[model samples]
Target: MLLVDFVLLSIIVGLLRKGSLKKIGEIPIRKLELIFLSLIIRYLPLFLKGSLKEYVVQYILVVSFISYGLLLYSLLSNWHLKPLRIVTLGVLLNFLAIIANGGKMPVSLLAVDFAGLGDFKQDLFNPLYPYHVAMMPKTRFKIFGDIFPLPKPYPNPKVFSLGDVLMGIGVFSLIQEAMLKKKSASDKISRRKLKRNL
Candidate 1:
């Protein structure tokens, strides 16, 4: 997805700079984005569960929220705003979701029952557990929004949602926008220099 974003963004930038796609209003709408969003929405309901489901859904949502927030800020901001704002939002959302859903993101203690991770599932369920990476922040997060390969799972593993994919795409788009801006600025500078010399 990131690679695709870069390619699409590069082409768009080239067109805009060359005056082929002359106006911001002329930009094409992203239809395929709707399909992607639908797929993500399918996973959002997992948060209501107490079992491993809730932890997985919430984890995906938080990551997506962060990534999407970053993407939106980069695209909409004047390019002068600090990037940290987007990153901070992502982190805060993740923390809040972790707190709201459970002390950790409700990992399946049962699954880790056999992993010999010293009762990882029990620790994840425990309200008193510290904010260790194994508990809240790390385990339940997405692995590119796919199945997790648990290494002695201490917390829940392999969960994500529609929000995560959206966030990933948004992050991809923002990066594309940044590269486009740089190319635009460079083109403008070259044009100005040429005009001055002429």
Candidate 2:
């Protein structure tokens, strides 16, 4: 959800900067299918938990590692893009944190409470959750966990990590670059056409 907000904000900023949505299609992102596939696999357990809870939980760690690997591979394939490199760094941070924390993201209880989502504390601590674990004194990679809070007055209150913040910035920059590039190209074409007509 926070990511959605980041994208929306980026698009709005791009439009304000006289950038066109048409240029988004011009961004040369590779292995787009792998990105989608990784997300689907990462969240598959959540959807199947009703009936296949045990099965999903049993292999959740393997599935998570595989999904993260796929995502990292896809991002690495586009390393030529500066913004994507930043995004790759962000993903790497998250991957390390998850791997160190036993295949689950550690969530700060203080951040959750600060975000006014205390009700979800139990879920975060639940062994069956298969995604997040409550941050504890012994939690590894605690610095990379979801320690930041987005309090109310912001449409959606939630907790996020440093990696998430970096990813958002990278995404914003990517959109801005695409939008400006399109505008520059169009201007060049118009100037060429004008000179030919004169």
Candidate 3:
């Protein structure tokens, strides 16, 4: 995931350096600001501490999803393409999985217990409450269980699926692209000013 993010960032920066998005640079940064804010808010659940944190995180999740959806809608209104579609699908899948699993991806409690997660009430067990009931898609229509993760040697490797990987890549790609475009526009503006002065 990190490697993919780095590669996407590099590509975006390279494109920006080429001044491909110079014209679009003049547009207001409000849209970009929303995206950046959303990114920060989306991850707040993982770091929040204390009893009230869960409620706070849940509220933030709802708001963040709505804001993100709106932001995507606004961005796609002016831009459309195959790459965007692929990224959108990945994001939607990830969101659905999260929502289906109680706003957080469920990990195997047994797996965690075996890994020596001493206290089950800690932040690590935030995914699922009890041993049997997991915030995950179960076999039955109404049941939900942490039926994810393939059989691996590690007891508690972060059990993320293929959808998550794709989503992460898409997110990284989008951010890198935006930053590169902004930087490129700034450089082009500077060059134009220099030419005018000369």
Candidate 4:
């Protein structure tokens, strides 16, 4: 998903500016473990036997929704940060769509074709292996689902949700601020040391 790519790119940008990886610090979530646990909950079922009936599959997705919700709440609790606030709104929008749709995210076929992901049933699943189904006539909050595309010629062509866009913005802003903050602190320390040496 673009969220993963967005986070990776944010860290890369910070490091490129000579900001130490440590400058990114811990994301200001109260229960950091919950975030990790959420990821595991969302992805652990992919390896399970596909022989699972439809309802069982849906239940697996329900567990994923709950886990992801906890993680989102942890992040939102720190919403005073501009980036976090933007990310929270985007996440809630996505959550609304997922929860309303049998716990599976809806991806528009048009978006998939636009991304050149092909019409293969297997390709229907997002590469993130998120429990997503094709968007139907009655999909709620369809705008929040994977309805946008990064088409061919893009390094990573993919269908993304509106939530993905806002999350990307938040991630970029968070890293930019952290890197600048670290630089300011370093400059202050250096000036102080220089004066003492003088």
Full ranking by TM-score: 2, 4, 3, 1
Clash count, one per candidate: 3, 0, 0, 0
Q: In candidate 4, which residue ranges exceed 4 Å CA deviation?
A: 26-28, 50-56, 123-130, 183-198
lDDT of 3 by residue, 48-141 (tens): 6766665665455474466457656644643543345445565555555555544554455554454454454275444322112243236222
Please, what are the lDDT tens digits per residue for candidate 2 over residues 91-118?
8888888888878889999999999998
By descending lDDT, how would the candidates be arranged?
2, 4, 3, 1
Q: Write the per-residue lDDT of candidate 4 for residues 1-198, one digit (tens) a residue.
A: 788788888888777877767666744546667778877777666766554533456585577578768869777767768787788777787788888877778889988888888853464554334478888898888988999989879788888899888878887887777765644688899999999999
- Candidate scoring better on TM-score of 3 and 4: 4
TM-scores, all candidates, are: 0.30, 0.90, 0.49, 0.81
- In model 4, what lDDT does residue 19 have? 70
Q: RMSD to native for every prediction?
A: 14.1, 2.7, 7.4, 4.0
- lDDT string, candidate 1, 42-151, tens digits: 33443445555545544554544444444444334423433423433443444444444433334433324434455454545544343222333455443222122344
What TM-score does candidate 4 get on C-alpha atoms?
0.81
For model 1, name the residue pairs that clash: 40-162, 107-156, 109-121
Q: Is candidate 2 or candidate 3 better by TM-score?
A: 2
lDDT for each candidate structure? 0.42, 0.88, 0.49, 0.76
**Residue 194 of candidate 2: its Cα lDDT?**
100
Instruction: Flag clash pairs in model 2.
Output: none
